[model samples]
Structures are given as structure tokens and as C-alpha cells.
Target: MATLMLQGTGSDVGKSVLVAGLCRALSNRGLRVMPFKPQNMSNNAAVTSDGGEIGRAQALQAIAARVELHSDMNPVLLKPQADRQSQLIVHGKVRGILGSSNFREARRNLLPQVMESYYRLSKQCDIVMVEGAGSPAEINLREGDIANMGFARVANVPVVLVGDIDRGGVIAAIAGTKMVIDSADSAMIHGFIINKFRGDPALFEDGYQSIEQISGWRGYGIVPWLSDAVRLPSEDAVILEKPVSSAKKRQIIACPILPRIANFDDLDPLKLEPEVELVMVPPGTPIPAEAALIILPGSKATIADMSAIRDQGWDIDMLSHHRRGGAIWGICGGYQMLGRTISDPHGIEGPIRDIAGLGLLDIATELAPLKELKAVRGTAFDEVLEGYEMHVGITSGADCKRPFALLQRQRPEGAISADGLVIGTYCHGFLGSTALRRAMLQRLRINSDGRDYVASVDAALDNIASELERYVDIDGLLRIAAGAGQ
Candidate 1:
């Protein structure tokens, strides 16, 4: 089996996107390719075919490779609950919360588990493309690092470093990484790829040669800016800081950018609608008054994010929107916040206490230790919608009598107010279904475009693969993966 790992000079340097594109390109060549990440820290997660959860990026890469989703793709996932603490997931199951200090020691001990997953995946695929988390240049973090160089060293995987030229300092970032790291780690990186280049690539020919001269690493070709990336689901919440769309004269769909928002990609389908303008209301900004729909997205910490909404005065603004006959929808943790009461007596998320909810739905929820992870199909407004459930609360009350959808054609899921203005559900990715999206738009008295969201995503993957094949050295990369060049 052949293996190649992609490590970046820093975070958000297009490493994940490059891996997805490469996976697609390689799979298109009739190669059995698989993507792996020893460790990942992100709240955006996706349910796998094995009835478990992994980082959302791995799930997207699996789709690109045309393979089944598996928890082994991402063995160690850390979902940040606070600045210093996170919930650790091992082998697709919650292992409990760990503070910053303890997590380091725990990570060192988890190396065997990570290797086990990597070996199992390598045995089944012709090529395994591994993605490194953050940078391998952080010497302080290199001691117990299972994310980057540490994993590369033990797994005997050749590494190709990537730097974002659009951010500038591409030469220093690449050469500087070589200067700081140990000789063994530095030797693992055989070549470098410059990503997100907007202007002429020839203009940077001198700068690219400078990096090759300084680091003694070959140039792996520069990748131009990918415009179709916006169609793919972003794995990081940092992307929410920027504007989603610049279009005007369209219906507005406003969503509050919670501090710990998870699965905010749930709004991606809505953003693609030509008739809708998706606005992510940042902190301290009130939800737009003219927004036809106010959506509360899923959160990693429901209680804390709920408190943050009140602190930002979004609660009052949402009430005003509701009074004006605007539609409101909440998913997952947001659904918990829309209920009458949210109780966590066991302190699953923090301090043990019960807090009042938005009171829009006459239901009550109690946070539990066990998380619900399942793939579901249902019908809402006479349209079929399929999604997954990843939550930790159980809800019940009078409003449930008017359920928002019939899940699995028998069980009722979610709750709707008697007035039919507010809807809440634990299901994520409901809008990905074309029929459901059209029905939702019709409910708001808007004409539906009836676009197939799944087809759009597939087309975006194909576009990216074509871009990679055009610029990247595919045969050279394959040789590097086979250890022929090294």
C-alpha cells in the first residue's frame, strides 16, 4: 500500500480542500483511495454509515472518493465546549470531557488507537491520503503530537507541505518550517505545494525557487483559487465570520452566528437559492427585521450559546420578528433552546441547573449523558426529507401533538407551534433534499427553483478534480506516494 500525507504551514491553508480534490482525482483514475486524519478538533461533525460520527471534512472527502463513511477515517475528534475544555471522541464514541492539561497526556496514550485505525484503513485501500491538523512547525506541540509529524514519522508516510500564497509570506512559511523543525521531521517532507494563488503563477516562480533552494524540497506545482469551493460544506466555523453571499433583491434568511455554532452548514442549501439571501448575523448584530425566516443553528454548547444570544440581545429581536409573523426554525441544540425549559441536572454541559428556553414551543427537554446518533428519513409538508441525528437531549410536551414531521413514516419527530410559525427539529441536513426545500419555500409563499442539491455537490467535486488535474502533477504525486521519488 502507498501512503502520502499533506501537512500545511498553518491552519486554514486549504489542506482539507486539496485532500478532497486529490481523493476525487485519484478515484477517478480507478484507484482505491481513502482519506484519514489521526486527530481533528472541530464541532462540525457528520454521522457515518457505521452508525458513528466523524469530522465533517472526512465525510465530505469520503463522498469525493465515492466510498462509505467510517469512523476509522477520523479516530480522535475533539469538540471544544469551552476555551480550555473539550469533549473527546475515540473510535466514534464519546470518551468524556478533558481539560487542556489532561488532554495532552491522553493524546499521547491514544497513539496506539490512532495507528490501529490507520493500519486497518491502509490494508483496504491502494492509497491512503492523510491530512495533518494545524502546523507541524509548533515545536512545543511536537512532543506528543499525533496530528502531524509524529503520525508521519511512525507511519512512514511521505509528507507534502502546503502553504497559502494568498495569505502572503509563503516563502518564509515554507522555509521557516524547515528551519524550526527537527531534522527527522523535516526530512519527511519531500515537496511543497502553493495553494490559493489568485494572480499569475509565473510571477512567483522566483519565490517558489527560493523555497526549493532554502528547504531542498521539490515544487509540487501551484493550485489556483477554486471558485467552486463555496458549494462544498466548510468544516470550520471560522468561515462564518465572513459574508456568505453578496447578492441583493432576494428574500432574506437570517441565522445568528453563535459563539459555538456546530453544523452551520445546515444553511448551505438555503444559501444556494437564487431567490434567498443568507445572512449570518454576527455577535452584537441583531437579526434583520425584514428576514422572512430566522434560523437558529446547532451549537456545541446549548446552554452557553443560549446565554450568549440573550447577552447579544438577539432574544428580544427574535421575539419582535415572531410577533411580526415571521417564520422561525431551530435544529438540534437550537431546537432544545426553543423549548419551554432545558434542564441539565447532571451538569452534562456545565453547571447543574435548569434554564428557561425561548418558550416558543410548549415542550420541555432534559439533557442526558447518552447521545443520539442515527440516520433518519421523514416527510414534512408532504415532501420527503432525510438527515441524521446527533444530539443529547430528550424532548416531550403538548406541542408534540403537532409534530413538524413524521420520521420513518411512523415515529413523530420535532415540534411545531399551533400557529404553524415556529418549527424545531433535531434532524440536520433536512434542506439538502430538493423536494423538502421546495416545500419549505412554498410554505413561505415563494416560488421554488427545484434544484438538486446533491447534484450540485457532486458537480462541485468534479470541477475541483478537473482543476487539480490541470495544475497538479498527478503522475509525479503518485510516484511520491509510491516512494519512488524519495
Candidate 2:
């Protein structure tokens, strides 16, 4: 099988989107394709059909390829729980926590597992599209790096460097990358693509030529800003900081941005609604008092983020919102926080043995060593919905008798308060289901546009594929992929 790697000059330079678009473009041309990432660092994740989890980006790319998600798609996944500590996932299973002190050495030792996954994936498809993380320019941290050039060199995968022209200095960024990285690593990059370009391509002809002359690499193409991308779920947290909306007349659904927020993409469907505005409140901000619904999102560190929310006084704000009869809902770790207490005797999530919850629900939770990662179909709001459960705790109490959903397995899940204004559940991605989502929103007196979320995402993929076909040299990329294997 053929292979090619896409490495960006920096993170969030459109590498993930480009790889996904390329996968779709190739798939449309009747080639069986697979997406791989040597390592991925993100709290946003997707549950694979194989009972594992991979980065949300890889999951999107897998969808683009019309293939099932697999743990082999991302061998090394890191979910950061603190400033210097991350929960390490190796081959789709949690190995343990990894500290910054032992990160380099431990990561270097993971090369075998990375390669094993890559080789297994390569055997299943005509071509494997590998995505690199961060930048090879971070040479100081390049010693034991398995994310970028280190993986490329070992796999012998030819690279296509992608530079974000919208950030300016496109010429310097592409050329500077070559100047900084070692000669051996530089040789792996076969060409460069300037991404997120604005205006006419002819207008930047001179700048494009300068990049080619300085870097001695062919210019593949310039990609314009994709407007449809907003329809798709975002894997990077950087998007949370950007100014997204200004509409005030729409109904508001506010969610706090915890330090270790996981599965925040659950709000993407709401963002797509013209009459709904999903506000992500940053740290130190009050949860909007005017919000019609206050959603407590899943977190990698439940107790820590719960403590953080208290520090931000969001707990008080939420309590006030509840007293005002505003709807409040929690998912996973957030669900744990709605309970009377969260006990962690095994320390699965950290050192604290137990912590008091918001006490909105009568339930109590205890973190367990076993993590549940399963896709389930359930009935919520009197409509059937598909969602996945990815968490590590067991909750029980009186409120649970008033379950928010009943799964296909005849299991009662989630809880609802006596007043029916508060709710908690462990299911993620249920908001993507139109009927159920609409029903849930109807409770708050909001109107949904009745759009099919999955179809919209598929259409977005097709649009990106069409754009890539128009701008990028897909034929040349295929040739590069083939040549590398030969």
C-alpha cells in the first residue's frame, strides 16, 4: 500500500482538514483509503466501531474515507488533564497517566506500538494518509518526538508541508521550516501547500513563487477559507477563543469551558441552528444569567474542573439559573458534578478521594477503574437517538428513577430532578440527532431548523472534496504516495 504524510508548519494550520479533504477526494476517485496519526493530543475524541477511541479529527477523516474508525488510526492518544500531566491512551486502551517529566522517554518507547498500528492499517487500504502533530520546528522537543518527522522518517512516508497563509508570512513560514529542521527531515517534505488563502490566487502569485524559490519545493496549490467547515465538529480548542457569533436575538445555550473539557463538540449541532446560540463561557466569566439552558459539558478531570467552576463562581451562577427555572443538563463528568457527591477511592481521576457535588440531583457517583466505551441507541424525549457512552463511573440515586433515556438494552440511563428542570446523562453526541434534539429544544420553547445533522456533515465533506479537487494536485499526491511505497 502507498503512504503520504501531511505535516504543518504549526498546529491548526488546516492540516487535519486537508488530510480529511484529501481522503474524501481520493475516495471519490474510487481508491480505498485509510487515515492514520502517529500521535494525537486532544480531549475531543470519537468512539471507534472496534470499541476504542481515536482523535475526533481522525474519526472525521475515517468518515471521509467511508471506513470504520479504528484504534489503529491513532496509536498514541494523549488527553491532557493538567498543565503537565496527560492520561496516556496506547492502542485505544488507557495505559496510565503520563507526566511531563517522563513524557519524552516514554513516548520514544511507543514507536513499536505506533509502527504496529501503521503497518496493520496499511495492509487494509490502497493508500494510508498519515497526519503529523504540532511542528517539526520544535527541534528542542524533537529528541524523542514520535508525532511528526520521527514517524515520517521511519515509515519512509513523503511529506507535503502545509502553511497557513491567512496567518501571514506564508513565504517565511514554509521556507523557515526547511531552514530550521535537520537536512534529513527536510528531505522528507516533497512540496508545500499554502492553506487558508484569501482573495484571488493570481493576486498572491509573486508570494507563492517566493515560497517555491526559497524552499526549493513545488507549490501544490492555495486553499481558500472553507465556510462549510463551521458545519463540522472542531477538534481543536483554539476555535473556542475566536469570536464566532454576535447575534443577540437568538436563544442562548451557555456551557462553561473547563480546563480539561472533553467532548465539547456536543454543542456543534446547536451552533448550526440559526435561532440558537451556544455560548462557551471561558474561565473567570459568569455563566450567562439570560441563558435559556445551561449545559455542563464532559471533562477529563471531573473533580478538578468542578473545583475550577466553583472558583469561577459558576456553581453559584448555575444554582441561580436553576432557581430561575432555567433548564440545566450535564453529560458524563458534568453529570457526576450534578450529584450529591463524587467518590474516587481508586483515584482514577486524581488524588481527591471524594468531593461534594452541586447536589442538583439526588444521585452519587464513584469513579471506577473500568472505562465504558460503547455505542448505544436509546429513546429520549419520546424519540429514538444514537449516542455513545465514554466514561468511567457509576451513578445511582432516587432521581435516576426518572431517567432521561431508555437504551435499546432495556437499561435506564441518566436522571431528572423532581421539578423536571434539571437533567444529567453519560451519553455524548445525542444532540446530533434531529428529532430528539428538536424535542429537547422544544422543551425550552426554541425552534429547530429541522436539518439532518449527519447529512449536513457528509455534504460538508463532499464540498471540501470538491474544493480540494479544484485547487490541490490530487493526482500528484497519489503519485507521491505510490512512489514512497516503491
lDDT of 2 by residue, 1-486 (tens): 899999999998999999999999999999999999999999999899889999999999999999999999999999998889999999998999999899999999999999999999998999999999998888987988899999988888999999998888878888889999999999899998989987898899999898899999988899998887887788999998887865654888999999999999988888767778888999878888999999999999999988998999999999999999999999999999999999999988778589999999999999999999989898998998888999999999999999999997779999999999999999999999999999999999998888888899999999999999999888888888897754
Residue lDDT tens for model 1, 1-486:
888999999999999999999999999999999899999999999998887899999999999999999999999999998889999999898999989879889999999999999999988999999999999998889988999999999888999999999999999999999999999999899899999999888988999899999999999889999999989999998888876546553888899999889999888888667788889999978899999999999999999988998999999998899999999999999998888999998899988988888999999999999999989998988989899999998999999899888998589999999899999999999999999999988888766688888899889999999999998887888888998123
> How does residue 14 of candidate 2 score in lDDT?
92
TM-score, each model?
0.98, 0.99
How many steric overlaps are in each model, in order?
Answer: 0, 0
- State the lDDT at 265 in candidate 1: 85
- How high is the CA lDDT of each candidate model? 0.91, 0.92
Candidate 2 off by > 4 Å: 246-249
